[model samples]
Target: MDIIKGVPLTSYILLCSILFAIGALGVLYRRNALVIFMCIELMLNAVNLLMVAFSRYFNDSNAQVFVFFIMAVAAAEVSVGLAILMMVYRNTKTTDIDALSKLKY
Candidate 1:
């Protein structure tokens, strides 16, 4: 645990894990779809940070490739998710997913 080594890998990973956990909790507890989307983004960023840390420590290109793929998937997911969110907002006049209870069909 060299405190002078300019941020240890384990510390970076632990911080990322904590941030991801906070994002997960926010998604679980928030009613607004937009806020949940933001939390999901936070979690994605955390994963990206972890991947970057691993890549740096191991001098590996595979982790960087994986991070790029994750970014692509996240971009696609946000595009589709925002479309659905717009529909939800149009129908309910609110972005709160919990407020839309008519999806039982």
Candidate 2:
């Protein structure tokens, strides 16, 4: 909790909120699949940051463990997601969301 002791909870909340909002906005407004994927990772990282912040604030290690698991899942997700995106790009020659309406093989 040493780091938590140095910073206020409110500051952590604000930073995570901003990060999540940016991620959400990018997911909603961005047309590129890769950009949207990165934004989703941003959102996940923001959540992980909040979880660690809360864990430290409350002196509980459970949230930190959960964050670790989440990070592992996110890593797996990125590997699979990037592969799919690459396949889509190869098929369509573009990564635009609108261009991927029908994914029929």
Candidate 3:
């Protein structure tokens, strides 16, 4: 659209980079599994944004198709990941990654 045309590709790249960095930092510094999972989703969305930006700039459809696939995969990942997290929380009463060490036995 006209709005997208006004923005430069570099700006999009920079924004996505910043988002990815924040996501990475959250994933590394946060102890809660749910927060880490949300960060992972943030990272994935950054990549998706980049892909859509590039696809629009290049007037290509393949990148958009890939984005759809990525969304599908993300959806499946979220369902399975949340299910596992729920089970873990039910068993351990906590979502902290460090708390999972008790499973070492």
Candidate 1, residues 1-105, lDDT tens digits: the string is 533467789998999999999999999999899999999999998999999889888889999999999999999999999999998888789997878888777
Looking at model 2, which ten-residue stretch has the lowest summed lDDT? Answer: 1-10
Per-residue alpha-carbon lDDT of model 3 for 13-33, expressed as tens digits? 999999999999999999999
Residue 99 C-alpha lDDT in model 1? 82
For candidate 1, the C-alpha RMSD (Å) to the true structure equals 3.2
In model 2, residue pairs whose N, Cα or C atoms come closer than 3 Å (at least 3 residues apart or on different chains), thus clashing, are none
Ranking by lDDT: 3, 2, 1
Model 2 residue 11 CA deviation in Å:
1.3
Tell me how candidate 2 scores on lDDT: 0.93
Ranking by TM-score: 3, 2, 1
Q: Could you say which candidate leads in TM-score? A: 3
C-alpha lDDT of residue 66 in model 2: 99
Candidate with the larger lDDT of 1 and 3 = 3
Worst 10 residues of 1 by lDDT: 1-10
Overall lDDT per candidate, in order of appearance: 0.91, 0.93, 0.95
